[model samples]
Target: MDYLLTEEQKMLKEMVAKFAKEEIAPVAREFEEKGIFPQEIVKKLGNLGLMGVAYPPEYNGAGMDNISYMIAIEEISRYCASTGVIVSAHSSLAVDPIYRFGTEEQKKKYLPALCSGERIGCFALTEPSSGSDAGSARTTAKLIGDKWVINGTKHFITNGEEAEVCVIFAHTDPSQKTKGISAFIVEKGTEGFRVGKHEKKLGINCTSTTELILEDCAIPKENILGDLNKGFKIAMVTLDGGRLGIASQALGIARAAIEDSIKFSKEREQFDQPICQFQAIQWMLANMNTEYEASWLLTYRGSLLKDKGLPYSKEAAMAKLKASETASFCADRAIQIHGGYGYTKEFDAERYLRDAKITEIYEGTNEIMRIVISAAMLK
Candidate 1:
């Protein structure tokens, strides 16, 4: 199997890398410090077609392949993971399911605004009680005449407060368990749909994350997404794509840490010589480079599999597992290389470390990724 990136993918990567360095790298620290969502920069990204890189051009997207999508994600993530999450969550987690399952009318009404970045989209599936056990969601959607009234709360929803549209999952028949779930398109400002307090997260501070409260929120029957009782499957399918995006994010963070650490080691004087000349520092750099390269290969391979229309669930999980762990490790090592300065916000290393930790927690935790890989092996 060929592992090389296509010329188009290479160009896409170069474009995003340049954009990240020039546009995002400069202001990442300020955003993190203020914990403010960079709406202006996000809008700029939308104009560049980074918001919907993988969707079709007919839907106001860039019409790129999965590899290009991953490249864009990695480049954006390298500079600022918060922005990466905002873009990745919208594209892979929210818009993808709608594009894949929505009726032509639904797509027409939603895809244009989302792809153009005029409107942001969010996915709401994890409830306070139902995280890894998504099948046990407490959110309910009850049919009442020609409308469905949804009542439930979704926690830790990325881009929740800022999203113009939300793809939510609810249980239509509790007795049916996972089979009872259904997806719905709920626009912001719908009566009874309230955005809750913003979460004080450990990382990805610039990405708006909050709870979604649906208190008897009503939507027309036409708003239902996909077949009735098929929302669980849709959620899982969407997560498969999201895992790939998270893997790309992890790869980017790791790459950045490695790059920074290498540069630091070359310039940092220790024992009257550059630290990079020391075997100890060189060994750490060597291990970091080796692991980062491995993680990138896994991430890119998963993207390629997705582009080929193949089953990429296991590959995506593997990529996420390896890349997230590698990112965390690389960030820790970067901090060590920088000594006391790394522990401070003066450098991006601390932010990378914080951001890398969340990658292992979100988009299916590293533990969950292991389970997926093991289950696939058994299958």
Candidate 2:
């Protein structure tokens, strides 16, 4: 229950909260309806040192901790889920890997641009054949003479269309199967790299989801990330951090729904009194608040354990699963509380519901989170 946040973390939360209110909230609806990625806002976030919240200043990062990063994501997501995902995917999936595993030369070459948002970054792991079974990926990379020649496709790649750099997984030794999988840093201008057609989705409409096409894409041998045949390990660890970010986003959705529901309940009258004054309405609000608080503790615990260099894979999964489901619950309850008004596009309640759904589906589905947790428990 004791958060005891450092001075820096408090400042970060306040700064991001203000920015979300003043900048993201005003345009969130228009952009979501238009299916437009908030590229300008993303750049502003980079300029504000949020694109790489926990990375070092030398790499153009804020040099903060995971808790600060989580708070930043939650606040931004409270306003715009699309933007929340953009920042999460860019920082947690893209930048963190390079910062964590890149060679000195590789870090020097990629980190500053990526961290500063001068060039956007994305991860390429999901494929047509392998979504949850990432180890079953069939993407191939042959080390030809000096360059690594890659041939395969990565589907459902967030930021794929706009990313300047990608942390891609491919099998260098197919005979080794999952063991052969290796991570690579592929630049956008590579000869055989291209973006597939964009996917129209149910929510998070403003973000891009496309296939990363690679046919004989050749890059320097030095581009190999981490050790050969260890990409699966790298990918798994990356997702652990990623789960925390998604959980925070889910928390944001729930928090936003609660704030809106309270505002509506006090103003919308029923039986000659406000809905909030009713016992049933009070129970709904109480349940939402209680679950939100519990989810926060789990989410913060995961981040705290991670920052302390302790084992937290199970904690991350638990937080992600609970928080994601909680988001959906709160969003649905918000609609129910609003009666007919919540169903329309004029209100953000429906948007929150739609946006909250994907939190369960991405960064490993809520189903996958359960699997991770059960496995951890059994082990």
Superposed model 2: Cα runs more than 4 Å off: 1-3
**Candidate 1 lDDT for residue 339:** 90
Candidate 1 lDDT score at position 125: 95
**Candidate 1 lDDT (Cα, 0 to 1):** 0.92
Error of 2 at 235 (Å): 0.3
TM-score of candidate 1 against the unseen true structure: 0.98
lDDT minimum window of 10 residues, candidate 1: 1-10
For model 2, what is the error of residue 323's alpha carbon versus the real structure, in angstroms, after optimal superposition? 0.7
What lDDT would each prediction earn against the true structure?
A: 0.92, 0.93
- Tens digits of per-residue lDDT for model 1, 1-379: 1248787778888888999999999998899878989899889899999999999989999999988988899899999999988999999988999999999999999998999999999999998999888999999999999999999999999999899899999999899889999999999999999999789977899988899999989998999999999999999999999998998898889989999998888888979999899888888899999998899889888998988999999999999999999999999999999999899987889989999999998878788889999999998
Per-residue lDDT of model 2, residues 1-379, tens digit only? 3356888888888899999999999999999999999989999999999999999999898899999999999999999998999999999999988988999999999999988988999999999999988888999999999999999999999998899999999998888867989999999999999999789998888899999999999999999999999999899899999999999999999999999999999999989999999999999999999999999999999999999999999999999999999999999999999999999988899999999999998889888899999999899
